[model samples]
Target: MRRFIDSEADFIFVLAANVASIQAEQDAIGFDAPDAKYPHKNAEGLCSFAVLVQEKFSDNPILMKMARIVQAADFKDQLDDHPAARGLQLISGGFPIVTSNDHETAERAGFLYDALYASIKDNVGL
Candidate 1:
């Protein structure tokens, strides 16, 4: 089923929540000095995406809520414990404007987002 957020405030909250979730993972796993680079890169990418979404659809609550959900998942730490988790994290992280309730949900959500993104890009001549 397609879940929708309906408001920009909700989207911001989702984004914050997902970011917080990621921070939680960082806290739990304790990355080494060398590993720190990738995490920082990931975070920067997320921030950039969020900025783009905010700029492109300032009034779309669905997009905002999706962002908040991504921020809330805490995928980093979860992945540290399970190999499968890493794939899910990458997928979800790639599309922060989508919401997933749990691991399975995350996978499905990622698939949906991937298809949607692909379709959009294809249709846009990108």
Candidate 2:
């Protein structure tokens, strides 16, 4: 957060458990909640970051697949909605996020996400 004090990102992502206050303050959305402008689900019944991104650019195949994957992974109880979700969770579980190294864990996971995105983009089928 302190890093953003000097430099602000074009899109502020608040993927937290409790996003009520943040939504009110920043007019942002969350992993599962919606604000005044954004809805929790889209017309296609997509939720999470999926709906948000889709609203802007729905023509891309890669983004749509990523959104589907994200929608499944966002729900803790329905992690099995997508086979990759459990694998991703397990892989991330191996990280040092528990030791308060969230930034480090996220940094390590960045490449993994990039790889996944690339895989999705390269493949024609979901």
Candidate 3:
């Protein structure tokens, strides 16, 4: 997945979104509707992923920042800490854009993930 993202391969973003969404759901255990898709159920695992990314990509400062974003987006409720949390919640829940087809949903959201990655990549200097 990392390679795909780096190489600008096709379908990488949507694939990532789908994979992340599914893993978050399966790894998730207990939570009420609307909140279930978020990482509230297993925050330890989510944070652990960030740690793993940090350890693996210690040289890539941008990836490390992404790790922090993932952690905060999944765990932090204070929007100031993780402004993307609300958007992640909505997208994961398939709110306004989700359709009956998972593939289609991923395909549509692929662009969004691509934009997000681009934003992260562009802000690497910051």
Candidate 4:
């Protein structure tokens, strides 16, 4: 998972320096390398991606909420104390079961994040 995070940071750094640098990639999507050769699940990639999103959208509550889930899921074993994090971890477990193809899984995950963001974006005072 850590390895995935490192690689994602590298990717984000490059993307930030390139196409996504001038304007915020507000439409940025998250992804998990489902079949990574790594020993454990690649939750770290999503975690890293969340970090990028947090940096880009500092005022976005929806993305921030999603980031909490990503952060929690990545560190769930040792640092997850929030109920939302725990629930996200459990829900994410099913993502792998939904599809074996990484691209499809990523697309689905993106949609899930979009829906999550949409669901929370309109609440006045949650």
Best by TM-score: 2
Q: Rank the candidates by TM-score, best first.
A: 2, 4, 3, 1
lDDT per residue (tens digit) for residues 1-126 in model 4? 122124353222123234333224543333333332221234443456465655676686766776666676766563454566666667767888988765566657767666666666665355
The residue-level lDDT of candidate 2 at 84 comes to: 79
Q: Rate the local accuracy (lDDT) of all candidates.
A: 0.43, 0.62, 0.53, 0.53
Residue 67, model 1, lDDT: 41
Counted clashes in each candidate structure: 15, 0, 0, 0
> TM-scores of all models?
0.29, 0.57, 0.47, 0.54
Alpha carbon lDDT of residue 5, candidate 3?
Answer: 28
- What RMSD does each model have against the real structure? 15.5, 5.8, 8.0, 10.5
Better of 2 and 4 by TM-score: 2
Stronger candidate by lDDT (1 vs 4): 4
Error of 3 at 83 (Å): 3.1
Residue 115 lDDT in candidate 1: 65
Tens digits of per-residue lDDT for model 3, 96-117? 4556675566566657656766
For model 4, what is the error of residue 77's alpha carbon versus the real structure, in angstroms, after optimal superposition? 3.3
| Model 1 C-alpha lDDT per residue in residues 3-112, reported as the tens digit of each score | 33332222111233255554456452212112432232254444333444565666755555444434333435433543333554666566545544444554566476
Kindly report which residue pairs in candidate 2 clash with one another. none
Per-residue CA lDDT of model 2 for 46-126, tens digit only, reads 664576556665887877777777677756676888877777667766777454665666556667777777898778665
Candidate 1 colliding pairs, count: 15
**What is candidate 4's local distance difference test score?**
0.53
